[model samples]
Target: MNVEAPWRGNNLARQIVVLSALSFMIIAAVIGAGAFGNTAVEDQQDGALSTNGSYLAPAGPAFSIWSVIYLGLIAYAIWQALPRQRTNRRQRALGWLIALTMTLNGLWLVTARFGTLFLTVVVIVLLLAALGWTFRVAVRTREPRGGVVDSILIDGVTGLHLGWVTLATVANTAAWLTTIAPASWEKAADAIGIGVLVVVGLIGLAIAWQSSWRLTPALALAWGLSWLAVERFGGEPRSTGIGVMAIIVAAFVLLPPAVIRILRLLRPSVD
Candidate 1:
């Protein structure tokens, strides 16, 4: 009569173990960005991953968001291992993908630390794709009854991960290009930078639309873009035009989702 429950129970045990180990690996890797005898990504590649490395790079301070995300991942790992979460349908649906993301996070960092710039870009793009798929799955799955905690731990983390990686993918591509592209490309850097920001804004909007205007992703994306704006406006190799475009694009990507969220809160049936 309830064979599904037993199956889920058995499967969740294995998932919990696997997820916990992956989470540990990811936490160490995130921390290893600066400590445990490892150098920061910005400092690793002869500073090629620094704020000044690419036109699309976010300012140095923007990276502080990594701490919050790392904490979120750690929290999620613990939360999902709890007995109450063991047989949860949402967790069952999302557990493996979430684990995949954590694994990818570690892999991306390792590639950045020891592999070539091209490998770094490849791993990050794959990480972004995995996060995007995870986000889609999260949106499609209905949270269980009284699942507010699940919403925060799973959906929220996935959204933030996907959003941050989206912008990171762009910056990583730009950094890789800088290493390989012609020096003459610098002449058109301004134009190319603005074009890239425009595309980033569109991608943000698409994700928001797909996820019913989820706020966490927009917040993370805007956070990265705002820092890029700050860097372009005040940091080395400044471009007032790119700075202004970044601000505009940040607002552009952020406002619609915010407005839609507000509308839904007020009307409660807008969707």
Candidate 2:
């Protein structure tokens, strides 16, 4: 199978996609940072995006990961647009999908700011799907073509994006549910939150195994889960049960890849 068949002779197309991705990244950063009358995500929709917006919502500081993600994305955009990278097969295979992810991210923020929670959820799910597709392609491409720097800017950033958005989808859906669910359901929030956390844990473990114990996604997942534990333990909608479950889920998601890395360090010839 010719790995380059799909992207053969697509240099112009690749360049276009890379430029569009960079443009979309800039737009998303602007919208996300509250530029041009765009309110913060938490401040929009009557605070439905806040930390207390849902039982599954992480703590306030958990969102700081956006800074890292956005920066990584910008770096990826610039890196992929370089003259030498313009004809790279790996970039050709990935550029269009990455552009789609960037576009979807900007669309999600726009929907969240100006549209309904339901619409925001819809856009986020789409964004997640785009990221998931990107992840699949990265896995299929397997060996990093452009070496360590390429692995970080492309694979690493994509993993972080996918992982964070995976958890965010859960929280976003929970927030949307709050609007439509019966008021009496409030009493069951803790149980529901725990169940969702368990599902998240399972998904994280699956990703870890499937990606050969990739650590970037695990880092993002654990970061988000840790903050959820912090919020539940100390913030409004406090629930010790949920907090403990969150910590447990975080640990489970992190342990597999972490242990793998430790073993590799101890036995350098294992891989």
Candidate 3:
């Protein structure tokens, strides 16, 4: 049993991540079954996020980001449970935050299902805050010499999670705005909406640049924006302007990290 002590020592933290993973799977299953579709009050999330829902809303394909996040989270859970990670510092710092994320995630889906758009926005914002905290911890935590496993399961995955949620909060808020904004604002809402996306997108870029140059977040953001551009350009409620702007924003958010990575590679090495 002495040999197993290290792995078992961090059971509490490990359990939190595992349970969090389980929670994500449960809610994902609910969404998959379409149990939340066409409720008495709200339409399915996809239907609600039409061209009319919010100009900020990406096309349906953009949501596939969840599948990637869910898979990464599952990988994280398993990785944390391994003997090597039980005493891992970064994993420990992130345990409770991961739990908080899973909780808020489920709550977001619940609020969405009940047609509580405002509450859904609140939950997603809280979720994003939790993820942001986790990323802070992730950036500070030290890693062992070989960090491949942790990098794949923790830093990389959580970065993507934080990135997507950052965009999601903005889009969700926009959905709420559609419900509350006056009908007279229709003429100017497009300008206001795209502006919001740009401001938040820049902020997200700054956060990711500080946290990690990993393209995980930018990739997810670009995925959503690329689809939003597609949806706006020619799909529904076509607005060549908004579509062009989204593509620009996506390129903007993605450019910094790509440039930084390239610079690092091109820099001269001290032999």
Q: Give the per-residue lDDT digits (tens) of candidate 3, residues 171-249.
A: 7888788778898887886688678878967876887677757677787888888888888876755677778888888
lDDT of 2 at 15: 72
Ranking by lDDT: 2, 1, 3
Candidate 1 C-alpha lDDT tens digits along 183-258? 9999999999999999999999999999989999999999999999999998966888888999999899999999
Q: For candidate 2, what is the TM-score?
A: 0.92
User: TM-score, each model?
Assistant: 0.93, 0.92, 0.86
lDDT (Cα, 0-100) at 83 in candidate 2: 76
Model 3 error, position 72 (Å): 0.6
Sort by TM-score, top down from the best? 1, 2, 3
Candidate 3 residue 164 Cα shift, in angstroms, is: 1.1
Any runs in candidate 1 off by more than 4 Å, and if so which?
1-10, 27-31, 142-146
Report the lDDT of model 3 for residue 111.
72
Candidate 2 lDDT over 175-259, as tens digits, reads 9998789999989988988998999999999888888788888889999999999999999779998999999999999988989
Prediction 1 global C-alpha lDDT: 0.85
